[model samples]
Target chain A: MDADVEAARPWVAEASPTFITLIDQNHLLSSLYNMVNVPQAVWIDEQGRVVRPTETGGSIDILREFDPEAGAFKPEAMARAGAAKALYMEAVEDWARNGADSRFAYDPDAARQRVSRQTPETMLAHAKFQLGRHLASLGRVVEAEALFTECRELHPDSWNIFRETTEKMDTGIAAGEAFWGKVMGLGEKQYYASIDMDGMP
Target chain B: MTIVLTETSNSECVAAPSTTDLWLDADAVTAATGWTLKPEGFCKDDICVPTPADAENYVADGKVNVASFWRLMDRPAAASKDGDVWFLGEGATERNDALLSLEAPDFTLPDFSGKLHSLTDFRRQRVLLITWASW
Candidate 1:
């Protein structure tokens, strides 16, 4: 459970029950839980049924404390993270008390539908990322670069995809910053775009 | 996505790309790692690979045969020069095995501090696995 929740650190520091944070080095848990985006969560019951699908959780009101316009740090990203956290936290609470009977729990059909909603574009990006990883491992840097570029173009909002692509490209590879930075900038721009589109305050 | 497994008396190996091109399945992996791929996934005692898929066609077609598939992929085979068998192949190479299933393979990964952990460790606990980068 590797997470960057500086906003929640204060709350966690002030909490009562003991809580431990696990750093997921390879995103094994994130992939297992189908957490495609930041602040997404899935609540699985003892029987292994997902009581709550991945949804935005936690409180976004905390963003009110930060200034987005400040240099280096984008406030809109903070706000988006907050909204996602709020939704996820709300779902968690619903599942915690109600168990299987919780209104938040999806029927098998709904769960399947939710899984299917991942969208072909998203799935293709995953494939492209995987293929890039494969090619990179094979020492075919050029081919891997192309695949990763396509992946970024398709999934511009995924920080993980962009980061992994850049890391695989390494520093010695030419056009490293220009190619990778373009995607990083796009992600930031999308973050701001999302806030405006959602009409978030 | 076919998983091809080829076996020899002393060893077995898995190859991929196309099972016809290489043996990339559980049996071959077991030969390489001394573990077996089962329905429950790759297992060596309690630890498992968890990326199990059918490799019948690959095996039957001899795509997993070490020597045959190596030649097909232009990968080198074990060469003995000084009485020590040196297996040669590009390390850190990624292979496309295809989307066998959406199920995530369960395994404990070693962190920077050399600690092994798994998703089950966070069961019944609140966890946030944030995948991000400094860049």
Candidate 2:
């Protein structure tokens, strides 16, 4: 979810999709779902049940190879990034067409296992982040910074809360040292837990 | 001066929860934390928790000791250093139950045009809810 709905609007318009697009400036979904990053997808069945928990929505950590000094993406990374969408979309289509019976759909137990719980610290982080945004909106920049710092400390895994004051968050693309540093630091870990589906590139 | 931060809004609260961790029942308590103080105890929907006998301070002057109520109910909460800005969160039991049930947490958000839509609006239909940032 994004605080800057207006900044994200142009992208929604560009997509020109038939699906409904909603805005969440408060990052309520992240708080509710325990989502740590953006560009994640949740598969919900007809009865408002989560059939599949968060997935990377086809975004791999492609920018890791990007030489920012050169201001260009390696061709290999670009190609892989281009194909990322189809990998996730194929899974979506399978579920859409097959519903609960889809091979991609998770069983109740499997699905439940994947859902992460909101810890006390995380819940507090949500409050601090929300308050930080509120304070920032009120022109209390220094106070907002203090709150943001505390919240980020409390929930270091939450890139959503950590990236609030960064580049237009609505874009889902984070730039600069802070974002890249985290990415690079994730040496052995998958940027987004690899979607369990087979044929994941 | 307590400030309650909910998912949707932030407002000043008349009550700040005391540090002893005993949550009381008072008018401002429910206003900020949503648990109503009843003769039976603090109740939300069908769930009611018996108020501690020692929790006598419901309201002091215009302030209600409302912050620690969530902790008393087995939930967790956080506050600013001065005890202002209570952030109440769903307890692990409640949150874990939803996960155990596999129920997608329902949310209502507004479209670009300002029309509100809930996740349940697509009930009975397979929906791929994708969260993206405009950043």
Candidate 3:
């Protein structure tokens, strides 16, 4: 749900995806579905019940494998990431073919429960981010920045908040220095939270 | 205490303290301000503005007088003449409510060509909705 639809167009067009590639300039997707980072996928059944909450898609790890020389990730971590991606893809295919019968599909109640464990702080971050998005939409850039900063302060681990906030301000904070520095401060091990796909069919 | 928080824009939905006191409940404070109390402070993310030492005086019966708290921070908030309703700036209670339900809130946004599409359009289909940015 990026604001820079123009920038994302070339990549989406190049991929030639058959699926829906919609824009969310206001980032309602993030605000609504707890999508704190890109490529976080959720599963829903034909009945429109959410069967899975937002999860790391792991596509980024495929790219990480090629850039091992970047020195941020170890070869072991890359392999773990690759295995995770393969497992995720397999689960997606299973769900696609098996529908609600898929072993990967959780019951609606289970999925809802999983998604409901948000801390009050996280909820506040989500609220602040939505307000920031609203202000940004209205061209209240300065006010939006204050809210965005508050969001960032509230949820430092949320890449969606940081990226969207910086991009809106044209702060160039994501231009490799400030962002990377923050990441480095957080440590490479803390980059992406590991997902447990062990029970997925 | 039973301080009512009224948004300057929409004064009708005055945030009333569920508990009696001049202090607003943490929940009420959260509703009034898009802020939840955390160990670090009244936090939103990685950043936290520390709570002042005397903040407890402003809180009573598990509620906080956020207007008083805002004053401690020197932030701006409007108070009504009767001093019962305090007006805070914009908040995201509605959005947070939508999110807590885990139901994908319907939204419409244009593609590169400006053709608008709603999330409801993909109902009954397995959607791989991904968020990507050019930046």
Candidate 4:
């Protein structure tokens, strides 16, 4: 994607069209606008105010089912996507009808307030997840594994968090069981020693 | 309150209590950019200005020069180097001044495929920026 963007830059610049293409990598705009997932969009007016809440944007063709041989893919995911698409289409229609003065337009203050409600716990989980990724990148697998586990515990509903935690644990277990084995060994030792001591007593 | 002054080329660094009636470290500004520091103010991005003696200096230099600040903070300066340019300060957890209501730090980073993107890209369009990871 980076290469694609870079490759497209010259053409984008050469054309220098009236349309502007702004990129957001750190998700500052996403967070401020309360965007929760990819392909989501929020419309901002010329005055730097969010005219629309975060919603899925772009055209989407809803798929009701998939190839059965591909394994068990939940139908709920498709349902959710369909719902999201409907909401986004509605949002776009609203924007088209009203522009900046649309009835559905979001108040800047209200939008900010909504964003502020993104609980500290959510932010902490985000932080922990990031730290876990950082640690994993640095080869601190054990620490990263622990952090990812904590992140999942903190944000159980975050699919990415859960997936990452499971993946890290699986990889760690497969590549090196010493860490987990040591923990298990400690537990076993404590259990047997306690039982033996109790029996003697 | 102890004001830690760390001076470096391109900017002055000052760490003091936040005066915005909000939780924010005085170090956030300096850590973001390698500005020279003094009681009066700090300098960065070739902009030298004074800060409120009693107020938290969010950006003594109005424009955020992410590259310079990252170098000053001893963090990776380039997005390519760090994968993500904005790193939540390690000091945030420990410091009473850690920002709570402060706006998110401005940064540019690559997408999943390592594509560099900036906030300005989606400025005209309503953007639903979602931060998700493979976990």
Candidate 5:
């Protein structure tokens, strides 16, 4: 869910997907499902039990080969993210067609166990993020910046955390130098954690 | 006790009035914690958490005892020994408890047109709930 509801609306309006779209200005899903990044997916069954923990869900196939000379992202990075997206979409389709019988669907216990990996630090990070959003909404830039920075430091793996916070402060990916340096440091292959599609039924 | 406002992220520090108790007005509480005191309790957005019965006991001189409010929610906070400045950290007690049950916590939010929608409205339907932001 997007915290910047206003910004997300235009894209939603353009795509006009025939599905329920929701906004999460507080990023509650991040804490609820241990989602560290955007475009992540969580599978739920008809009975309302989560069948899959949050995982990277996106397709970067449309992205032309990463031209390092012309773009900030590396080719290998986009390739890895794309591969994960393809596999994730496949699993999603399997679940859609087969429901609970799908090999890709995890039982309640499995889902819980997978998401249980969230550490106390990560949980705190989530809180810091929500606080940051609240402060930002009130126009408390200095305070919000502190909390957002805390969130990123506490959960370095959560790129969305950094991206969201920095973008709000106008010091993120668009800022060029710092953003590119961090991205380069975190190689493209590791941009989105690789999806775990191996243990499917 | 003097409340020293220190920036945890960058180690910047500022000192506020020295006092024995950390009394924050309602507006200050909202700005610091994102939760506003409502008739239902401390609320943020569409979700409301009931304020503890002992909440009133913490109020004195028409200011809220932030430390006590934190205690009521079973959250932790740190304050300078002098009590002039306090830094409230993020509290996840409620969020963690809700997540432990694996049942989606219900909330309401307004759409682009300011129309409100609740999560429970879609009960029993296979929902592919997706969250995205412009950034």
Candidate 6:
């Protein structure tokens, strides 16, 4: 979900997927599902319910390999970027064919268990984010910036908020210096939350 | 009391007066959220919950204390420094229920052509929703 629709449309057209591709300028999906990062995913059954909450969707921060100064990845350092993606892609195909019977799909209890529980802080963070975004839409940049900064502080795990807020404010380079700052700041913490499918290493 | 303008994901609410206690007049409550105050409590459609037993704490003069109402509805609320912008967030219990039902929370979004699409429109078929951004 990006505010800049025209900028991203060309790339999406180039891919030319058969499925429907929609733009979420309001970040509705992320807010509804409590998603904190892009390249994350959720599976839904025919009934229109979420079977998977949020998975890292094979993004392993290859962006980190890009030196902000050089603006490119170090040679050979990007090898494993989509390493697990092939496996996940295969699983989706199986799911399409087998429906809920696919081993990749989670059952009701398990699926419910997997959905992230919203906390007081998370809810409040979202509130701050909404208010900030509204102000930004109204061109109240200074006010929006303050609320967005508060949103990031309240929900540090929400890289979506952090990245989007930083990008909107034209603060630091969100994809470059800002990205590395987030990654490096996570000292000893796991950047990606582990997925539970078999044959995933 | 100062009137604070507010808007939600879809609708603009009646300009509710600012109250440190979150006491919104009856009209503001309906406009801010679809739920309407009833004898039982605040309700929308078939779902209803009892308002707090202490009537004086909730109903005073003509305003209803929405903060107390929100607690019963299980919503979390926030507003800007001036309270001009208010957001009442979805509660945990309701989100949990949607998960248990295994029904995907449907949304309407626009395509490159600006045509709207709803997830429910694709129902009767499985969907693999992969979220990505140009960032």
For DockQ, the strongest prediction is: 2
TM-score of chain B of each: 0.32, 0.74, 0.47, 0.31, 0.49, 0.77
Tens digit per residue, CA lDDT, model 2, A48-138: 8888887677787775678767789888888877777787788788888899889989988898777777777787777677767766676
Instruction: Give me candidate 1's TM-score against the actual structure.
Output: 0.47
Here, model 1's chain A TM-score works out at 0.50
Q: What is the lDDT of residue B126 in candidate 3?
A: 73
lDDT of 6 by residue, A45-128 (tens): 888867776777865645446665876686554555555677878888888999888988888789878777656676667766
Sort order, TM-score high to low:
2, 6, 5, 3, 1, 4
lDDT of each: 0.42, 0.72, 0.60, 0.40, 0.61, 0.71
Model 5 alpha-carbon drift over 4 Å, by segment: A1-3, A59-65, A70-86, A167-175, A187-189, A199-201, B1-100
Clashes of each: 24, 8, 18, 24, 11, 5
What's the residue-level lDDT of A138 in candidate 6? 74
Tell me the deviation in Å of residue B79 in model 2.
4.1
Tens digits of per-residue lDDT for model 4, A1-201: 111244345544676655334433222332233333334454555433554444434423222233448654456656655665566556557766667665556565554443323444444555555555554555777876776677656654343344335533432221134323432444323211111011121
True contacts kept of each: 0.04, 0.73, 0.38, 0.13, 0.26, 0.72
Scored against the true structure, residue B125 in model 1 reaches a CA lDDT of 47
List each model's interface RMSD: 10.4, 2.3, 6.7, 9.5, 5.1, 2.6
TM-score of every candidate relative to the true structure: 0.47, 0.86, 0.61, 0.44, 0.66, 0.85
Q: Give the CAPRI rating of model 2.
A: medium
Give the alpha carbon lDDT tens digit for every residue of A1-201 in model 5: 566666677788999977656666677667666676667776765666667766666533223345758765575766666676677667777888888888888776776766645666776677567656655665777877887788899888876687677644342123355555676676555555555577321
Query: Which DockQ values do the candidates obtain, in the order shown?
Result: 0.09, 0.61, 0.20, 0.13, 0.20, 0.59
Give the winner by DockQ: 2 or 5.
Answer: 2
- Model 3 chain B worst lDDT run, 10 consecutive residues: B4-13
Model 6 iRMS (Å) reads 2.6
Best by TM-score: 2
Is candidate 2 or 5 superior in lDDT?
2
